[model samples]
Target chain A: MSEIIRLTTPLKDEDIVKLKVGDNVLISGVIYTARDAAHKRMIEALEKGEPLPFDVKGQIIYYVGPSPARPGRSIGAAGPTTSYRMNPYAPKLIALGLKGMIGKGKMSDEVKEYCQKYKAIYFGAVGGAGALLAERIKSAEVIAYEDLGPEAVRKLVVEDFPAIVVYDTHGGDLEEMGKLQYRE
Target chain B: MRVVDVSEITEAVAKLCIDANYNLPEDVYEALKRALDEEKSPVGKSVLKMIIENADLAREGVAPICQDCGLGVVFIEIGQDVHLVGGSLKEAIFEGVRRGYREGYLRKSTCHPFTRANVGDNTPPVIHYDIVPGDKIRIVVAPKGGGSENMSMVTMLKPADGLQGVIETVVKRVDEAGGNPCPPIIVGVGVGGTFERSAFLAKKALLRHVGKPNPDMELAKIEKIMLERINKLGIGPMGWGGTVTALAVHFEMEPVHIASLPVAININCHAARHKEIVI
Candidate 1:
């Protein structure tokens, strides 16, 4: 069994550090969705000193580009995307007070190092378990990059959104540890 | 000789597109159940359990199995004696995809190459067709997700590298892919064809039933060995780690130039969505 913890958006630095690799988290409150395209625009905005679409302080940005919501649905089957594509832009956002990332796949060594240095934690959601994960989201609204279609940045209110800590703030890696445990 | 209307093809393809997105093929579903029953790592078992549950929910058409509904990859085998009437075969397929994505509430994942602009209707699907001897046309719709497709690889090994070389290449691809392609992946290996055919073969191999083996027992043995070696890597379910890194390994081989041994690796996420129709 794994440790179950509840986390809210605009996550606290202290709370992030308390999460060790492999902890199970049920994230609540407001979270933002930003995939590869949105990350690019945010980095460009940062370089130009232009304002970001939303404040990054204490935020957990999920790497997702959700499918179109059907009639009367809050959102379509929303799930974490492969996070490695956003590696180039993650450390900058981490430096700008981003506390957590919810996405699937491994981060780069640079991103891993930055998570430790900047006190951010990277979590992995089930990659293909989108339909199941969508049940936890209560509301969805596009906030940026409307032209990106499914890749648009959306703000979502989630309740008990589940994830596993892949990279802890202290540079621990759950995947490596998990793999080693079963090695024969 | 047989006559078939392209409109019928369009309707069939549209339905297939939606069905493939919502439903996990029987073979894939059974393999996931087996993986859940067999996986040793507790975390791995938990992930597999979630995957099995997800499949049940996705079958209702409430939402696609994955957020990435995937590009519409269609494989067709048309009998030489059949007369096709109505719209262009290519257009019919795309039209089906367009209708499927829009009406089924599936994601439109296709995009223009350079600018990354959304293609809107998920049109201009990736399609392959071959002419066969029968009077019936067969179509298989495989919604290939980006996560796994991006991890696929192709290499030209020196013919002397032999079968061992091919095995090593596939195992390495899965190892490097790790958690990215989504674990308990179904690996499709295309061996010995030319560069292009090898890639196509790899993708085509994915259309095989997950638990089925090549009729060639020698190649089936290779697939078995490859599956065993891959599971030993401890990638497990969703890369959480366990004894079931891959549910199955399907390989298709063809003759190649004497000097070149080309091999391609295509990985399908646990969501391996595809369905077949014969007309």
Candidate 2:
């Protein structure tokens, strides 16, 4: 196991530049949540040259549509949704200055190519570990698209949020590496 | 003949929904534990450990095991001797799903496919009904998540494709899916019947307990061989890579049309949530 790197949200170029694939990270601070529906809306806004519900520059968008909070809790079982569904909208966001994305599953080649070109990073969270992941989120408030139900965009305050670097700007690929290492 | 009220069905379905979401079935949990023990990679073991812990946390009734609570899939075995009264069986099940999702704090995942409109309540559940001999109704609720559901596929092979064709198609489906379906996945293979019936059987097979072999010795042996081939792909846990890519491969095969050999594969993530009730 490698040293677990600590990171704060709204990641800067320097914060992500030195990172490599397979590095473990504990991200703390504010991040935004958006799934398939919200992504489409955001992209439409950008295409129309209108201001987005949130900024893309130096921000991280987590692909998740959390269950409703259990009254006293700030969030419900919040975990990463499949990232591939967001592949189409990701490169557009990355090109517009989104520096990091947190989600599970494989990303497309275009998204990966954009990440390499723009010095961005893609982190894979443990899929299906929702109840456990919600522990890292201190608070959540919908920032836009309330009608989207669980898929609404929310501003999330997190602490020690766990994830692994799956794709790095420096051309390291953990998915491929992991498969090759153990492949029969 | 015995009479059964739709309200009774509704109540049971509602409760089953909540219970299924909050607790991981013993079969699934134990299979995961066994996978953890057998997994060769440190990362795979750690991932499995997190899954186990998440299941424990969800049992506290405070959080769900996964955010994708799934579009509720219900399987009901209705006794032919029972007369259902007070409401339509279909609407009663929908009412149960609506209440269960709203009250249990489960996510409403159904939508207008083309418009992408939220359906408010998780209704129009994928309900499968079977006619049996008794006076009771047996309902099984299995919430199918999008991640694994998206990886499922159906193919119509020539009759000549035979057993080898079935094996190749299923193995290839998992291989193509890789980690996207969530590794250490439970694969359900359906053979024979019509093209659509085969797909249905593949899904129904997912309702079976993980790690249990098919009752038919011939199919059981094939299940074992297919499982070995899938794990050898080294998809590992969550595709992080390792030795335990799949925990189990289950099959439900039936005799089909002489000209058609249809194969359908449905993959379920390790979190496979399901519960059964008799009323």
Candidate 3:
């Protein structure tokens, strides 16, 4: 059984140290959004020894490209996209002090290993619960890659953002947990 | 031949786009409700609850069920005896999609596959048309999200490969998909058609009400067996541990040449947004 962890703003490596697969986390803080295209640019900037657009240390990145917001709304129905697409870029970010990732789907072996080595957690948000999830985001502003449209990077203030730990620093996985329970 | 004006078709298509995006189909809603009851894990149950609540919120005008309203996918069935008047049928459908996405506050998700550039306003929907027997037009709008579409696969196997081959391929695909397509998914399998046709049938099969069996007893039996095996994979709702990995499996089959057997599997996440209108 996994424990529920309450996380606040300015997440730290120590805050995620005890997190294991199958844990439930209710996060309250600011998180940045980046999908496939944005991730590429961030990593490319890092590789060139150039300064990143935003400080990634102790930060969590959500993989999402939301719909256009309606009138008076800060953001549209915002839900996590598949994480596997970010597998190639995730470990690189983790090495740069990134503490967590929020999305749906399993990570690559390298990503899992990086989490175990670097004290990062992989959080799974309800895949289609965009509208409900968006309700948690108090505000949002485009931060980088404006030309990428929905794929641009954005800074968001969220409250009680719900997620489950799919992968943890301890190398555990919820996918394995379920498979064990259901395996005949 | 009867003539149907493009403007009328546009109105029908527009309504379909909005309704399909906003409301969860009754059959799909029932399936999710049933899954919530059957789900064993606390986490799985909670996830299911949130999904149900999301649907309710969307219906109540609180929010959309999902943010990715998806590129408009329209399937049109025109009666052979009827002619479209005033303008191109395709253009009118595109206009409807544009208006619906704008008025409904649904996202415009279409982009260039390689360049990844957005086509503003979500125009030029993917329209599939077929001529049928009636003098009336039938339109179905299914907004397929990216997560589920990413998990879809198409495989071509030898005729000698048979049923077992089909089963193994599907299982492999689902296993590989893991939590990506979102668990408690609905699996749609298309068998025996040509390559493209098989893919089409797989997507079309998703239109069936969840947990409802195919009319063909043999295919229905296959669906049941596949459903049992897939759930047994332990990929529960949202890929968390539970007994309700997939709410249902739907299959559509067509005759193929003796030398070839093609299979395609299209997965739909819990949302499964779709609606239909006829005129």
Candidate 4:
């Protein structure tokens, strides 16, 4: 059985430890958005030992590149992007004390191993539910790579953001577990 | 010759692009609902619930279905009797695409393939036009996102390889794809057509309503079988593993040369944003 938990932004290492595969979570507070371009920059920054644009410690990074907001709207359609593209960079971030990742799709083996070793959790939001998800984002501001267009990194404040645990700190994966039940 | 004004076509194309991007078609909505009910994994079911809810919210003008609005793919079936007037047909279509992306507030995702430079306004839509025996023009607009588009595959198999080879290849492609294309996906399989035609047919197959069978009984059966086998792979909604990896398997096939058995697989995310208009 899986438990439903509410996670706030700047997620703690302990909080991530408590999560397991198949857990349903309603995340609130702050989450940072980054996609392929941002991920590349983040990793590059780490490699250069330069100051990162944002503090990743005890933070959750969401893989997304939202649509442009209409007037008066803080953010536009905000759905999770595929996570596999971030696989190469994820372990390094995990080594940096990153506590959580929010996206859709399967993680690479290295990513899964890092999550287990570093006590982090991988959560999946509904992939196409951008409009609904955007509704939960109370505010958003570009933090880096403005020229990358939608792929820019944005600091987001959200409330009741829905997600489910696809990978957990203990090496349990909802994807693996679910497959076992249905496999012929 | 019937004269068709280029301006009229441009306006219609623009509207179709915006409409297709913003609205989730009725048939697609129903298909997701049915998938949710039939999905066996609790986790998968929950994901489907979110997808359905997202669609409802999009309909209510709450949000766009997905963040990636995708490249504008326009398929035009021109009436053979019609003669284009006023301006270049291709230019008119491109103008429509530009206006639509801007007005719709949709993302501009097009870029140079190798250099990876943005194309500014998402112009130069991938227009596939065909002249047919008709008095009316039929346009089908499908905005294909990169995630699923990236997962698409084309292969040339030996003639003796048979259906088993086709099945194995598709399964491998999806398996390698894992959650990248955003399961529960809709798999569009194009078999037997020439290399390029197979790819075209694969994309066209995605325009069909989920779970709807082909008129050809043989092809329809193949669709069902493939659907079952894919689900059995245990890649559920969003690739989290479950009994509903694919909501539907659509196959489009045509006769090909004896030497070739070309197969193309195109995957559509849960969003499956597409719409049609006739003028």
Q: What is candidate 3's lDDT per residue for B87-169, written digit by digit as tens?
A: 88888999899888888888888888888788877877888999999799999999988889989999899878899889888
Give the lDDT of residue A120 in candidate 4: 87
Model 1, position B142, has a per-residue lDDT of 94
RMSD of every prediction: 1.0, 0.9, 1.4, 1.5
Considering every candidate listed, which one attains the maximal DockQ? 2
The sequence of per-residue lDDT tens digits that candidate 2 reaches over residues B1-279 is 999899999998898888888899999999999999999988888889999999999999769999999989999999999999998999999999999999999999999999899999998899999999989899999999999999999999998988999899898889888878877899999986898899998998898889899999999999999999998988899898899989899999999998899999999999899999998
Model 1 Cα lDDT, one tens digit per residue, A1-184: 6779999887988898899988889999999999988888889998999999999999999998888887988999988899999999999999988988988878899989989998999999999998899989999999988999888888999999989999998889877887788755
> Clashes in model 2: which pairs?
none
**Model 1: per-residue lDDT, tens digit, B161-240?**
99999999999999889899999899999986589999998998998999699999999999999999999888888787
Candidate 3 has a TM-score of 0.97
> Which run of 10 residues does model 4 chain B get worst, by summed lDDT?
B111-120
Which stretch of 10 consecutive residues in model 1 chain A shows the poorest summed lDDT? A175-184
Candidate 2: regions farther than 4 A off: none
Q: What is the lDDT of residue A166 in candidate 3?
A: 85
lDDT of 4 by residue, B53-113 (tens): 8888777766578878889899999999888889999998899888888887778888777
Q: What is the DockQ for all candidates, taken in turn?
A: 0.79, 0.84, 0.73, 0.73
Which CAPRI level is candidate 1?
medium
Q: Candidate 3: which docking quality band?
A: medium
Model 4 chain A worst lDDT run, 10 consecutive residues: A175-184
Deviation from native of the Cα of residue B260 in model 2, angstroms: 0.9
Best by lDDT: 2
Pitting candidate 1 against candidate 2, the one with the higher lDDT is 2
Please report the interface RMSD of model 1 to 1 decimal: 1.0
